[model samples]
Target: MRVGAHVSISSSKATSDSVTPPHENIANAVFRQKEVGGNCGQIFTHSPQVWKHQEITDEDAATFREETEAELDGPWVIHSSYLVNLCTPKDGLREKSIDSMQKEVDAAARLGVEYVNVHLGAHTGAGVEQGLENAASALDELDVPDGVTVLVESDAGSGTKLGGDFEHLATVIEKADLDIDVCLDTAHAFAAGYDLSTAEGVDDTVAAFDDEIGLEHLKCVHLNDSKHECGTNKDEHAHIGEGYIGEDGMNAFVNHPDLAEVPLVLETPNEAEKGFEWDIARVKELREN
Candidate 1:
């Protein structure tokens, strides 16, 4: 059960602990993960909304690595900036995306993080073939460090977005010169019309993914329940078992032998005072042996 939430690394968000100077730095994420009863998790180096990248002091990076190694079962992932569009055909946007990803991977190496998660982004009328080519070429430009791997995440199939289909994921991996992997977002996959709302649907979707992209390339699972119906293409996430992918579907997905060892990171929304702690507990409960 390598499960955790996408915890914040910002020092501004104080921890729930009574200790003074709580949530001091990025290392605070280690404490935050424990607070929510999570063993592994994800974080953003800075605000994903902005283009500015935060510089991590060597001390901060070392402390984060040391504490995480000592306190938690870790394979921490750095989620890249939301603005990065590796699929964009526009020259300016593509260059910025490459630059942003380069900094993120460098940051990952510094922090001893194992993976950098990112979306393939919208094709924006460039069409699927061109967008995939653009993404592959863009990834080829990155000099990813020895320990870190970039994971292209699945997307909610909206407008001209890519990575929603299993074929899209397979294509990117096939076309890219640099070795890469994937992070399958449950909510996004559901929105993209991969039915995950029933036991049968779960089997079919898993088989489809294996057939198209190969399960070996799936390094992570963003386990979330979708707010909308199976094919709605909506990206909102609900609590673990309360949304369309309800108790039965979730139980089947979590207990499936093929996914037993894959890390599950919750991107579920908070409501009624229920947050990561509640969601993590729910996931553990749903997962039988």
Candidate 2:
């Protein structure tokens, strides 16, 4: 399994930030992974700011692939910007959202990234049903280049978010074409009230995902621990094995029969004085056990 974190890729190399051009970022991430003892990872292709547009040239995309392959030593995945919310109410904003999503789609295709994961977005006071429809419409309107597919990530279900449960994600995928997929976030699933820590709970959750969202569509997994309790409906990420998910829950996820074959990325908090040493060790232990 590919296990790593959401690394930052900054535009400026002089700064200590993790943000770099896609190629440099991947190369750097590989180094960071080795430094922190990670075997696999994921990163955002561009700056996540939705308000600020990012431009990618053909030479940049090509060089990025070349450098990443030459420098990094792990399977890599790309995350779309956080600003994209397909469930928006305003028509103009919806158009911009679609445009932005397509840009990422295009970039992913050019870079040959296997998956482009996206959040289903909060409805912003709009009805959940409407938000789902809007999301479906936006996805249907997008033109994804060949060899790249979009994965809708499950959220914490706070407020008008559409992907808190299997049913909501199923509805969106059902309405859209078959190419779309889903990425289950363990923390969000737990905060959304799915008890994934227990054997029975993990089985039930996987069963529901299979029956409702189609297990075939599950392309990725976000291995995060929730800072909130079950049913909290909040989005707070904690270091692995240190929060509400606990060591047992993480073990359950790592050893999950269904998730065993899929790639798992850590979006865990790893920047404190302690660094990601503990988090990496926890995942390694689980994988070994």
Candidate 3:
């Protein structure tokens, strides 16, 4: 059961660490993930709110690679900024999105991370085909390093956002000239109307994904529980087992054989009572040894 959380890679030690530190700069994510009992995880290079970029010194990047190889069981994924909207029809925004993705892929190379995760953003009235074309072409602009692969993530399907339907993911992969993959966020899929609340639903959803877009492309799972009901198009994440995709759904998800080898990187909420540590522990408890 390879499971972890999205730990902060904030240069500020306090924001990055949940445990006491003998920490080294941005490499603190490895320490933070270990302390939270996660063997695989995700990180944001800088704050995702604005368009700013962050730097990683060669020394720190080397240390991060060394410690992660020695400590973690799964690959690291860098989540791109929220402001990146590849599906946008606007010219300026599309350029910004491409540049942002380029930075993310480059950073993933420097950090020795395997995947760079991003949303397709919204179409904003470009319609589905044009939006998908925009996203694929935007991704085509990047000179992604050899080892790192950009993973287009599933969306919550709110408004004009793409990637809710499995076909949307397949379409981008087909259209993009660059080699890419998928990261299925469980809560987002649920909000997008793919049932995952029961054993049958989980099985059906996996089958649908396999049919629409081969399972071989599923590189990661954002193992989260949804705060909203199925098909609500809401994207709030709940503590594992405490929301609409409750204990049964979570248990089924963690133990599902089709997803057994895929790393589970949680983006669950940090509540007063339960956070990453608690959720990671819950996942361990759910999986059969």
lDDT of 2 by residue, 1-289 (tens): 5666666555344122553334443345555555566666677766788545566677766766675576554556677778888998988878878888888788787776767788889889888888998899899998888888889999889888879988889999888874788889999999999987676788888898899888898878888888999889988988887888788878887888888877778888866555565677778898899
Error of 1 at 251 (Å): 0.5
TM of each candidate vs. truth: 0.97, 0.89, 0.96
Question: Considering only N, C-alpha and C atoms within 3 Å, which residue pairs clash in candidate 2?
Answer: 8-18, 9-19, 9-20, 10-19, 10-20
Return whichever of 2 and 3 wins on lDDT: 3
* Cα error, candidate 3, residue 94 (Å): 0.9
**Cα lDDT, all candidates:** 0.91, 0.78, 0.91
Worst 10 residues of 1 by lDDT: 14-23
lDDT of 1 by residue, 152-249 (tens): 99998899999999899899999999999999999999999998988899999999999999999988999999889888889999999899988888
Q: For model 3, how does the per-residue alpha-carbon lDDT over 7-82 read when each residue is reduced to its tens digit? A: 9875455433454545656788988899789999999988899888877889888988998999998789999999
Off by over 4 Å in 3: 11-18
